[model samples]
Target chain A: MGRFVIRRLLQAIPVLLGTTFLIFAIVYALPGDPIQALAGERRVDPILAATLREQFHLNDPLIVRYGYYLRDIVSGNFGTTFRGLPVSTIFEGKFAVTLKLATTALLFEAVIGIGLGLWAALRRGRWEDKAILAFTLLLVSIPTLVSGFVLQLVLGVQLKTSLGIAFFPVAGVQDGIRSYLLPGFVLATVSIAYLTRLTRTSLMETLRADYVRTAVAKGMPRSRVLGRHALRNSLIPLVTYLGADLGALMGGAVITETIFNLPGIGQQLFTSVYLRENPVVVGIVTVLVLIYIVANLVVDLLYAVLDPRIRYE
Target chain B: MKNPSIDTHPPADEVAQEPLLVVDNLHVEFATRQGVVRAVNGVSYTVNAGESLAVLGESGSGKSVTAQAIMGILDMPPARIPKGEVRFRGTDVLQLSEQARGQIRGQRIAMIFQDALSALNPVFTVGWQIGEMFRVHRGMSRRDANNKAVELMDRVRIPAARQRVNDYPHQFSGGMRQRIMIAMAIALDPEVLIADEPTTALDVTVQAQIMDLLAELQRESNMGLILITHDLGVVADVADKIAVMYAGRIVEHALVHDIYKNPAHPYSKGLLDSIPRVDMKGQELYAIKGLPPNLLNMPPGCAFHPRCPYGRPNCVTDVPPLYEISGTRGSACHYYREVLDGTVQ
Candidate 1:
């Protein structure tokens, strides 16, 4: 098992490297002068700008600059912003916020999504099943960005602009629950839709499996048969989806964070790209890729626990 | 082979004892988009403790469905048993509450299905599955159930059972997995066991091994075993009585020896003739000429007349009721006497 995890980690090296190259390419190609952008409105002399370029190694080849960034990344030094603030220090606070949002959203999605799927599967072909399925399809059909805005307009809008009361706080991280609720709910709905569809199909197929029939024939109670025998088997695919989705969600649903004005890493990454903070952009991308790989490894281990036939070796 | 000496019962006393399971005029129908499928029609049979009743039929002949009905495992909505009574020791099971039925379904009467590889849960260890039988019905502690699971595996003749108990369904051979299913079914010493084509998915050698294992288990427990199969060869040696099903009803019910010597139904005759015999050598093996009747749109009267060699004109107009051939046997044919007397070929 240890060897399996190590091998998986080794294989992820190239994926991380490729992502770094892509992030580096984007930051390297931005059109503005780094010194001029840093100076903002100041009328800096062309000679001073030239001298600053040399000091920053701007005259060197892209490869040389990328090599320096890579060395810093390997050594756990995430370079700095144009203002010289360390990338790691800036990321630390946002990381916790993003992590909390993703975790809470994941919990909400899994509970609601998997619960609906099991209910629909059990009451298959009934009106309630049809309604849940239609609702899931509707949720899946609407893009998260559109839904996010619509939610902000209704629940987040203080109706006094037209009617009178705000049901949920519209934007920004505030104290306690108000901080993540609206944005988290929007993020969770999309994942909940996907999870619902995946879980429903998986569970329906599993319920028809011969083992489920055997379980029933064994005279196991309906609860145990569905819970222990049916749902446990169905979770293999659902868990795999969850693992992949976690890293992606944690990296950020850009539209949700941007619309809600959350200072998450994804929103930061989006802002830093336009600002030409190359190191911060590359730093966030590298971290996300590593997170994705780790999540997949954890999912693989979970598979072994859920199914005895699967061996890590 | 390792079963203790079976307690012998005198024939008169065996006859007087109440049957463990009695399916009387049972009707099972499946409602589909196309139409209502008459899966089991007026199917009636009885199994007594220590006896083996083999229900024989081809695919689509409702043998397995009947077994499922008896086990109380048939899915509703599609399946509806509108008429008939499944009497357990004189108590009608249809009238029993769900919990009461469950009390008998797996505790007093358990089932072993075909396709054992699929029947055993792949996600769970074979021991866990067997242990589940104990855990759910008897309410045994996990450790005690686990220990009992190992003991049951050892009883089923699984090699290295202590080590193999942790192995999942996919890890075992088909025969071994069937053994695990049998072990789970018989864990609580059920008085009746219905094995639905238990050996169908296994190779010939494995089939024999499973049969031997089942026979040993049955002998030791004296359980009423309902062996449902299409293969005549598998059951002829083990079954005491046999019921040959045509379409959805029992066409011939007789002692195994009597049925083998003088089959009272043409479908039974045809089935027996189709078995390839080594003694027959190079001659083309006989096969029943046509398919069984479609359930959704069955033939006008008798369901088997299309392929029955001795089918008379009346067979197309009227369904023949089961005719008493002797005190212990009956045949659902207009001219069972003629067939038994070897007058109809």
Candidate 2:
């Protein structure tokens, strides 16, 4: 196990390097000069612009710029933003919020989705299964932005209008759990639909396996047969999907965060890109990529725990 | 070793008089996308206590379906027993409530499947699953159940019962896993043990060992054993009575020795002739021509007439009921006497 973990850690180094390099190249390749954009169209001397370019090392070749970027990252100098603020400070604050939102949304989706999935699979061909299928289809078909807007309107506008008071906050995270509920649920809604469908299908297939029949023949209680035997085996496919989709969700959060006006790294990156700020966008994107890589590593390790057939080596 | 005293409470003759399990006119059909396919058609048989009945048939002959129907394990939508009565100990198991049926499943009757490895859960230890029967049915505490589970493992002759009890199903060999399955089935000392092709998946040596173990265990417990298989050789020493099923119906039923020596039905004779024997060296083994009839649209009269070499014109137009040829033998054919006397041949 130790050897396996070491191998996985070593493997991750190249992945991190490759992703960081790709993001660096793509960000640098974007049109418009960062220094020129930052200075705006004020009547400034060309020499002053040249001096600013030289100071920022913008005069260097692309490879030299990449080398400097890698060196600064290694030296704990994430570089100053176009506004001259520390990149780390901006990232740390916004990342904390994004992490909290994503974690809450993931937890909510996993619980509700898995629970509903088990219920639906057990009650297959019944009205409850149909109802869950309909609700999940509706949730998955609608765009995230539309879901966020509709939820805001229904829970935010309609409730406040009818009840003469707001039961759910319209936007922003505050007021403890209540503040996080609407936006968190909006993000979780679509994910829940996807996860529930996956869980139900996998569980149904697992329940039909020969081992399940054997367990029943052993006179195991229906609940234990379903929970202990069927559920655990069914989770293998579901876990794979969850692991693969984590990166996509992190990328998708930008849209969801914008629609709901949540203060997360996604919103920060959006604003930074609009302002043509290089440091914050590059830093956040690199960190998010690192997070995705780490999540996949954790999932790979977790696979061994879930299935006995998987040897670490 | 001292001679073990036989169980005398249930008198041998009286026990034979009472049926431990009766499957009456069972008709199981599956509703496919195309149409309804009849899997088991009007199949009926009875098992007496302390007796081993072998339901012999080839693959796709509804042998396993009949066993599953008795166990109440058939999925209802696809597999519906349209007409049947599975009476266990004078109670109709099919009509029983799910809870009541579950109560009787492992405690009164148990089953061992063909593939031992696939039948056992890969994640859990074999001992834990075996102990589950006691825990679920008898409500034994975990520690007590574990001890009894070890005892069962030892009874089935699984080596190092104490240490190996903690091992998962995959840790054991194929033969050992089958022993574990047997251990689980006999854990609760069920009255009827249904072993569906118990040794079909094992080597000849392991097959002999499993059969020996089953016979020894059955004698000790005096339990009714129903051996479902296609191999006649495997049942030679174990089965007391043999029921030959062909295309969802029993074509012949008789004492094991009697059927082997003088098979009354043409299909049964063909099955016996098909088995390669040590005495028949260099001779081409007999093969039953054509496949079993399609249940959806079987032949009008006899299901086996199409495959029977001695089939007559009347065999295709008249369905022969199971008729008694002697005091202990029965055959479902109109020309049983003529076939037995070699007149038809």
Candidate 3:
């Protein structure tokens, strides 16, 4: 097992390197100079612009700039943003907010989704199963942005007056738990639908397995048959989806955050790109890529733990 | 190969006075997408306490289905017992409510499945799974259950029961897993134990050991043993009576010695002839001509008529009822005498 984990960790190195390098190249290759964007609309002397370019290493060759970036990255420096803020400082504050929101959303999705899935599977061919299936399908098909706007209008605008002052704060993450409730729920609904369907299908398949039948014949109660035997075995496929979904959710939260006006890494990335702040954009992309790699690694390790048959190698 | 000393004890007839389990006119069918497939058609048999009854048939011959029906574990919507009475201690099992049936299932009647590797849950320790029977049914405490589990493991001859009790099913060898299954089945001292092809997945040597274990356990407990398998050789030493099932019907039912020495039904004759005996050298061992009949579209008369070597014109038009040929021995064949006397050959 130790050997297998070591092999997997070794394999992850090249993947992480490739991802980081690709994002670095793409951010640099995009049109519009960071130096020009930083200089802004106000008039500045050409001599001063040249001095600024040299200071920021913008006049250096692409490879030389890349080497300097790599050196700074190795020394735990992500360079300074075009706004002259340290990349780490910008990311630390924004990342904490995004992490809190995303983590809460994911936890909510997993619990509600998996619980709904088990309920649907157990009550198969009944009205409750049909209702859950139809509702989840509806939730899945509706666009996340549209859903967020709709929820914001209903729960934030009209419901506040009609339904005894709406419980959740419509925008931002400042109003404690209530402020996060709307956007978090909106972000989670789509993922919850997807996960619930996946879990339901996987659980249904597991319940029909010969081993489940054997367990039942052993005089195991219906609850134990479903919980201990079927659910544990069914988690293999669900875990796989969870890892990939976590990566996608971190990357995909851009639109939802924009719609709800939540101050998260996704929103910060959007602002950085639009403002042509090269360092912040590049740093956020690199972090997102790193998150993907780490999430996959965690998933691979978890797979080995959940299923005895799986070897990391 | 006569055992005169063993024979001196008593023949099966003398001991057939009290039946431990009696299954009468058992009809089982499955509602599939195509249609209702008659899996078990009017099958009947009896097993006395301390007797091992072997229901012999190839795959899909309704052997396992019969066993499952008897154990009350048949998945209902798909598998329905259209007609039957599985009476244990004069109580019709099928007539009981779901809760009542569950009460009797593991406590009174237990089943050991074919695939031992899959029979046990892969995630849980074998001991925990085994102990669950006691914990769930008997309401034993956790410590008591664990101790009982270790005792069971030791009884099955699993080495180092103390250490291995914590090991999952995947950690054990195939033979050892099968032993664990046997231990679970015998844990509660069930009155009737149904072993459905218990050794089918084991090696030849392991198969012998499992059979020996089953026999030893049965003798000690005096439980009615229902050994379901297609292997005629397996029943040679263990089964007191043998019932040959074909197309879901018991075509031949007799004492094990009688069936082996004087097989009456043409299907039974074919089955006995097919086994490659050490005494019968290179003169081509017989193979039954065709596959067992499809239950969905079974033949109008005897289901085995298409495959029976001694099939007659009447055999194609009429189903033969099980007729008593001698004391406590019966055959569903019109020409039983001819087959037994070698005239059919």
Candidate 4:
């Protein structure tokens, strides 16, 4: 198992390099000059622009610039923006905020999704099942952009002012962990819907399996039959989805972060892309790619744990 | 060969005692979108302690469904008992509360299925699954249960029982897996063991081995055994009596030897003739004509009339009741005399 993990880690190096290079090339190819944009509608002195370009290797070919970026990356240097702020420095606390938000979203997705799914599966063809199916459909239909703003208005703004409940802050991370609740739910909304449906289908299928019938014949109570015999098999697919979705929640937080005004890496990523900060953009993407690879590896390892038929070797 | 030692019945006084299990006038139905499927209609049979009764039928004959109904494991939303009693030692288990029925299920009346691969939980070790019978029913410690599991595995003749006990169901061969299933079913020393097509999924050689193992185990424990199968060949040596089912009802009931030598029902004769024989090498094997009737839309009258060679006009309009051929035999056919006397024409 250890060898399998090590081999997987070794295989990830090429993936990391390929993805980072693609992002680097794409950002370099975007129309518009970052140096020219830096002057912002005013005419920049040609000599000063030339000196800045030379320092930042703006005249170098894409391959040479990428080589320099790789070298610096290897040496623990993520490079600097036009404002002379290091990319790593910009990422320092913001990554933690994004992590917190992603974790919160994941927790919400798991608890509510699996709970609703089990309920729906067990009560299949009943009113409760129909109600849960309808609710998940509604969640899936609404996009995060709409859900984030709408929830903010009702729960954060309206309730705080009219009811004087002060239930949640309208914006920003001033209230620490409490501030992430609204945005986290908004980020998790669609995922929660998909997961609930998957859970329902998986649990329903497992419950019908011949082994489950044997469990029943073994005289196991309904609860033990479901909890022990059915639930373990049902959880395999859900774990795979949740593990991969962790990286997605972290990377896909742009809209939610913007609406809630949380100073997370997602907000930084949006700003950096607009300002054409190639180094910051590429650095953040590299970290995300690494995170994605690690998450997938963990998911693969978890498969061996959940199913005895699957072996890493 | 039928072993005479195991074939011995109890003394005359106990012969009159209540049989171990009785499934009387049992009806099982499924509510489907197409219509209500009457899967089992008034099927009745009795199994005595220290005896084996084989319920013979092809697929969809409600043999397995009858077994599931007895176990109280039928999913009731779609499956409704609606009628009949499953009496174990004179108690109607169908009337008992689910909790009470559950207590009787594994501890008193255990069951094994045909496909051992799907029947055994894949993720758990064989030891854990076998040990579960003890842990859940007897409240044994994990270690004690595991030790008991190993002992049971050995009893079922699983090679290297101690080493193989920790392996998953997928790791075992088909024969070995079935042995594990048998071990698990018999772990609690239940008075009755219901095996549904237990040897159907196994190869011929392995099938013989498994049947032998079951018979040997039955002889040792003297538990009443209900062997449900489609194969007439597998039942000859193991089962003392046979109940052949057609559609959802028992069409024939007799001693195994009587059914083999001369079947009173044409359907039973048809089944016996279908088996290939060296003496009839040049002739094409006889097949019972037509398929079993659809449960949703069964043909009126005798369910087997369409397939019976001697099917007559009344056979089309009148359902045949089980007529007593002798004190210990019955056949659900209007012309049992003609079929038995070879006067069908």
**DockQ for all candidate structures vs. native:** 0.75, 0.66, 0.58, 0.85
Error of 2 at A310 (Å): 2.5
Comparing only chain B with the true structure, the TM-scores of all models are 0.94, 0.94, 0.93, 0.95
**TM-score for each predicted model, relative to the true structure:** 0.90, 0.91, 0.91, 0.94
RMSD of each predicted structure: 5.1, 4.8, 5.8, 4.6
In candidate 2, residue A17 scores what lDDT? 85
Residue B248 of model 3: what lDDT?
A: 89
**Which parts of model 1 have CA positions greater than 4 angstroms off?**
A22-68, A81-85, A159-167, B1-17
Segments of candidate 4 deviating more than 4 angstroms: A40-65, B1-16
Tens-digit lDDT track of model 1 for B199-277? 9999999999899888888999999999999999999879999999988999999999999998998889988999999
> What CAPRI grade goes to candidate 2?
medium
Residue A89 accuracy (lDDT) in model 2: 82
DockQ score for model 2, please? 0.66
Per DockQ, what order, best first? Answer: 4, 1, 2, 3
Q: Which residue pairs show backbone clashes in model 3? A: none
Q: What DockQ class does candidate 3 belong to?
A: medium
Candidate 2 regions with alpha-carbon error over 4 angstroms: A1-11, A40-77, A311-313, B1-16, B278-284
Number of the top candidate by DockQ? 4
